[model samples]
Target: MLGIDCPKPKGRWPTAPFDPRFPKQNQTRNCYQNLLDYRPCVKRMRRRGKSTQPCEYYFRVFHALCPMSWVQRWTEIKDGTFAGKI
Candidate 1:
């Protein structure tokens, strides 16, 4: 379930949780954790003038970090809600 070969779903994936301890770094860290490295995507989103909601960035980060298979399985897990995932 933690590997890179999981099957991702077709629809949009859910968002990852935010880290409370590091509020300032939460967006960057969470996005990195989810998308592996979303600096470019974040920049693109910013260029596109998208709303800078944490959840939106988090979802993009998730798409970047997770494999296609894992994205599919994520819907089944239902464990990574706003409350917590790890």
Candidate 2:
């Protein structure tokens, strides 16, 4: 048993918590919505001179659920091409 005898790490990885709004098994829509929500939350907080720390929740959720490629693509095109309101 290769490495089976080794002790496992003691840390838990962070992931998105259950959202009642997205109760379905397929999380594609959840991922997209979180991505959309994160931007506006950050923008609004910045505009109001409030701390953006709370917006990290949405960022973490979308980061965990969305594919890196999709995130990268959206980041590249979000200035003009992204349809979701930020």
Candidate 3:
């Protein structure tokens, strides 16, 4: 038998963690909040001349929950059009 080393799997699938604020089964608001939070985090970090790495958490959460089309459309609009305070 040919000997080969297989790499062990790393972490679990990229999904949002349970947020105490949104304990209910519905995650619609959770997804929306993440999207809103992500933008402001990026803006704030950039304004402070800091890395945007921390904002990735919000980005990951929203992407996991929100539909692609909605994310795309929301992102495409300028800041003025976005209802959220980004």
The CA lDDT of each predicted structure is 0.47, 0.75, 0.74
lDDT of 3 at 65: 88
RMSD of each: 12.1, 11.0, 11.4
Error of 2 at 86 (Å): 2.9
- Model 3, position 66, has a per-residue lDDT of 84
User: Judged by lDDT relative to the true structure, which candidate is superior, 1 or 2?
Assistant: 2
List runs of model 1 lying over 4 Å from the truth: 1-53, 78-86
Candidate 1 C-alpha lDDT tens digits along 1-86: 32223233457755555566447733544544554333334445567888434434555546654565855555444433422323
Per-residue lDDT of 67 in model 2: 92
Model 3, 1-86: lDDT tens digits are 00111123256646788999899999999999998888778778878999877887787788788887987777677646777765
lDDT value, candidate 1, whole model? 0.47
For model 3, the run of ten residues with the poorest summed lDDT: 1-10
lDDT of 2 by residue, 1-86 (tens): 11112122245648889999989999999999998888888778878999877887787788789998987667766364677965
